[model samples]
Target: NAGVTQTPKFRILKIGQSMTLQCTQDMNHNYMYWYRQDPGMGLKLIYYSVGAGITDKGEVPNGYNVSRSTTEDFPLRLELAAPSQTSVYFCASRPRDNEQFFGPGTRLTVL
Candidate 1:
């Protein structure tokens, strides 16, 4: 089964360009999350959803927003992006807790 998928593999955005990072899982997990990792840094949670229609913000949700409309998809929206938002974004999920599987990642570069 495809655990989680994110695309496009890389992106370049101008100072204010907007984009949506798509995430989907075939595992039917109840929990999904969005996280960003700067170079040589730990992953910081941006948003999480326990189940469909139940989304919540996390540690670093400032420049991002997420929605959980179905058990399979949780997409991240970046509006009016800034240079500070340049980082690798990952989509993850857990059937339980504390142990999550991540997507390959979306490398975003904002200039």
Candidate 2:
């Protein structure tokens, strides 16, 4: 089974535009997360969901939103994209064991 998959591997957006990054997993995991990594920084969590219909913001969520409607999918929305939002976004999922499986990641550039 595919552990995790992300769509639109690369995107370039003008400032103020909006986009949604898609993530899906066939593992039936109970936890899903969205994270971003800047050019010189480590990955930072943006949002997470413990299960379906439950979602919460993480370290950085100002320019993004997320929803978990099913255990297999977690999509992150960027409203009014900004240059600061330009980063590589990754989606991850894991079961109760706490080992996370990450998606290949979507690289977004806001100019």
Candidate 3:
């Protein structure tokens, strides 16, 4: 899909606040992906980028924003963090002909 917006597009966070999920990888890779893993479940795609300055939404792009300003950095912005968004986030990078290399992941709790 091109874009997605929740019914209640904006909400003021009560306890949990916004955060920028940082994903780091080699400068040589051209593709990067972001995913979140909940308890006892598999990772769900949040966003991805083909190269610098190019990004697109993945399966679960809600409540998140991503930008690829440079090859070495792809940051996911968690907006109005909600409890549902609490999970361990994984960042993976891969070259055109190589398998993806994922980071340990960042644990985020929106509560």
Candidate 4:
């Protein structure tokens, strides 16, 4: 099973443009998270869901949103893209007492 997967491995968006980054997992994990990695920086949490219908803003959620409607999927939505948002986005999932599994990641460039 695909532990976790993300679509559009790479994307370019103009300033103010919006896009949705898709994430899915096959591990039946109840926890899902979105994180961004900037050059020379560690991953920063953007959003997360503990389970279906329960989502919360993370450390860097100002320009993004997310919803968890099922156990396998959590999509991150960028409302208004900006240069500051250009980074590699990673999706991760974990079951209780298990290590988190991460997606390959989506590289976003805002011009």
Instruction: Please write out the lDDT profile of model 3 over residues 4-105, one tens digit for every residue.
Output: 111122233444587677766754788999888898889899999999999999999988999999987888887677888877788888889878878767
TM-score of 1: 0.95
Model 2: C-alpha RMSD to truth?
0.6
Which regions in candidate 1 have their CA more than 4 angstroms from the true location?
none
What lDDT score is found at residue 52 in candidate 3? Answer: 96
Model 2, which residues run further than 4 Å from truth?
A: none
Model 4 gets an lDDT of: 0.95
Candidates 2 and 4: which is better by lDDT?
4
lDDT of 2 by residue, 20-99 (tens): 99999999999999999997899999999999999999999898988888889999999899999999999999998979
After aligning candidate 3 to the native by TM-score, how far in Å is the CA of 5 from where it should be?
A: 29
TM-score of each: 0.95, 0.98, 0.83, 0.98
TM-score of candidate 3 on Cα atoms, chains taken together: 0.83
Clashing pairs for model 4 are none
lDDT of every predicted structure (CA atoms): 0.93, 0.95, 0.77, 0.95
Candidate 4 Cα deviation (angstroms), residue 24: 0.3
* Cα error of candidate 3 at position 87, Å: 0.3
Ten contiguous residues minimizing lDDT sum, candidate 4: 56-65
Give the worst 10-residue stretch by lDDT in candidate 1: 93-102
Candidate 3 local distance difference test against the native? 0.77
